[model samples]
Target: MRVKKGPLVVIGDTLLDIDVEGSAERIAPDAPVPVVDVEGEHLRPGGAGLAALLTARDGADVVLVTALADDPQGRTLRSLLNGHLEVVRMPLHGTTVCKTRVRARGQTLVRIDTGDGRALARVTDTVRAAVRRAGAVLVSDYGRGVAGTVLELLGEVRAPIVWDPHPRGSMPVRGCALVTPSELEARRLCPPPYTSPDLAARHLTKALHAQAVAVTLGSHGAAFAHAGGHHSRIPPPTLASGHDVCGAGDRFAGASALALRDGLPVEDAVAVGVGEASRFVEGGGAAAIRLQSHEMGDRPRTPMEVAELVRASGGRLIATGGCFDLLHAGHVSLLRRARALGDALIVCVNSDASAKRLKGPGRPVVGQRDRVEVLRALACVDAVMVFEEDTPAQVIERLRPHVWVKGGDYAGRELAEAESLRRIGAETVVLASVPGRSTTGLIAAVQET
Candidate 1:
């Protein structure tokens, strides 16, 4: 039950991103081409669909208006967004837009795009009504024709608008709240050899007659220019190397719209947007999209799945086990340190039965599902699994993690998981816990009050 304050309306074109990952070990005999032995594939919502999904995931109630053809890809897109959003799909006259990328090992080999690029159907009364009722509006234009109709429809709405513009898309009207463009797009908007991001932002703001413009500068962060004659640069949060940056701009736009809809000032909203985008990239970006399925409810991973993931990562796996019924600063600090020791951190949470058995009756103030969600929200926790046993010995044996981490409470004391760790040939590490931060103590103080 945490709900955002109001509904956000998003208008633009939706696309399907298909990634085919395989091994390209041999070249074709007839032609000079690498023959890829297909292994796996992934499909994700892209374009404005991705922006709407990101906004909903940020806790906002979203109404997404877009066009979709009556095709297999369109059906897949609808299925993917079934429960996540209130999608108002217009009947498109052409084929659904699809971006198919073929990757070998980890590198992209080739990409093929399929679309008719036909003009979108005109906006309907329903879309206009939704826009009128929105607390805020976001236009995620991907240079697709859908944005053209959407921009025309939004001309009459007075709500704050966050336009993520494309060079070929419809230009935003005057007095809009914000416009965001990547550095490359910014340069195109204001003409080339642009001296600095600040100048580009200022120029775009004035040309679009918008209140502000935020130009995203990849790893360096974002530059902002407001109509009030103020300009500033917002740095991104530190992120690990080698993370996939796909969908980061969508996340930034969605987060900024959410903050602004909730009444945060422009500067603060831009900061929140930058932070959200950085976290999204740091947490795996496109690679993490599959994990969103588990957010609806806790789908505790089996030991086999966890092992497969660890193997796929080709990195050391670090694991820790605890009730984690109530997350606090101590838990965050410990998890952060544990993640630093390896490429991924897997948290083994105690099941409800196990928590009740260990902590006596009236324990686990938070339910198992809620606890898993809380733990999953942490950037340091890459995966979560629930163990029914009082101790995580079974899980440890199954996972055979590279390192087993414990908090300061277990320092200098014999650990119940020691035998399991030894059997699995996993090294054990004890991290110092934050002072005066214990769930038990917190519960006691609450009861006393």
Candidate 2:
């Protein structure tokens, strides 16, 4: 589905989710519980922040309105979200909300939640103005006070509203475009224990007086009931076992809101939501929601710009130069290993003219634009630049990367760029080449056939 060409305004509570993963080998001596030997930890945006992120990732401009405290976690949350979207933070008196989960081998063993759920400071004039000007509004109420303010301002907004409801939060006003709730959340609206998704959706639609209500049924897909007396079910795409389902609902809400804002009918929008959530789960769930460079709303930088960015982030800069006329597994392996050696990798590609000079006439199977695009699409390559010089000396001097990577083919030979790299005090490392994988070999094989 295509995203609309306007800003999606998300109003709700912002939360920090900390996932501590490791091995739980032996049981504790004092208790029967297993002791987890933590291997790593990841901090992610949760609640409304996640909804905003998903919307932005779906190719929509998003504005996030939420409350944050003046504590360290709040500072970290702001830092993490700063470049991702247009965030309007209303300072609250309490500490920022945080949920920490300890997991062993993908199973969450324990969770610790910290924060006050008291009312936040009232929404500022800035948030009110943003709501009025938004192309669409997504209310992700995790029972926080921000949703209350958004509900108060709904009358001022003419945009379509998609509300992901919480039992603890304020009830949605009549005429809301859609209300999405998980089956568990939907059950709270109707009779307890054994309510079907269809009945729950109908109950929600009638209770909220919304245009439609969608009840998400995890693996079974979603059930939708319209005020106009139409009902539909949108099935999920096939997902692998043990998939991360944590943020699937948020992905659905965000994508569906974008579709509805683009004027898709309720059923069609629900289909888009199902598709987005399915993709998210099938792609490894929460693991797929990490921060990406494109989410910062910045265009690809030039060499000078990249240098400045690397310096500012205080990350190691790894550089490699190649023709990359035809991308192959060998190129991918080298790039991945090079990225592992540093915080970021910059691949210097030979310009079209330089490629022709180095590889002879009609050598480069692909043009420079397509070559750069292909390289940039690889997760291992953070940035790409084109150089016209025969050697990458000019680019090397400009970047002065911390590490200069070369493939195994150059291990025993005197590298032409060694002197240039030495002048900049950059260390050079040679990585092993993958056996039987090369662009040249592929070209020769095709020619033989």
RMSD values, in order shown: 7.6, 12.5
Model 1: what TM-score? 0.73
Highest TM-score against the true fold, candidate = 1
Candidate 1 lDDT over 66-114, as tens digits, reads 8888889888999888777799877777888899889886677898999
TM-score for each predicted model, relative to the true structure: 0.73, 0.68
lDDT for residue 192 in candidate 1, whole number 0-100: 69
Candidate 1: stretches off by over 4 Å: 1-4, 117-119, 191-193, 291-347, 351-363, 366-449
Q: lDDT values of the candidates? A: 0.80, 0.80
lDDT of 1: 0.80
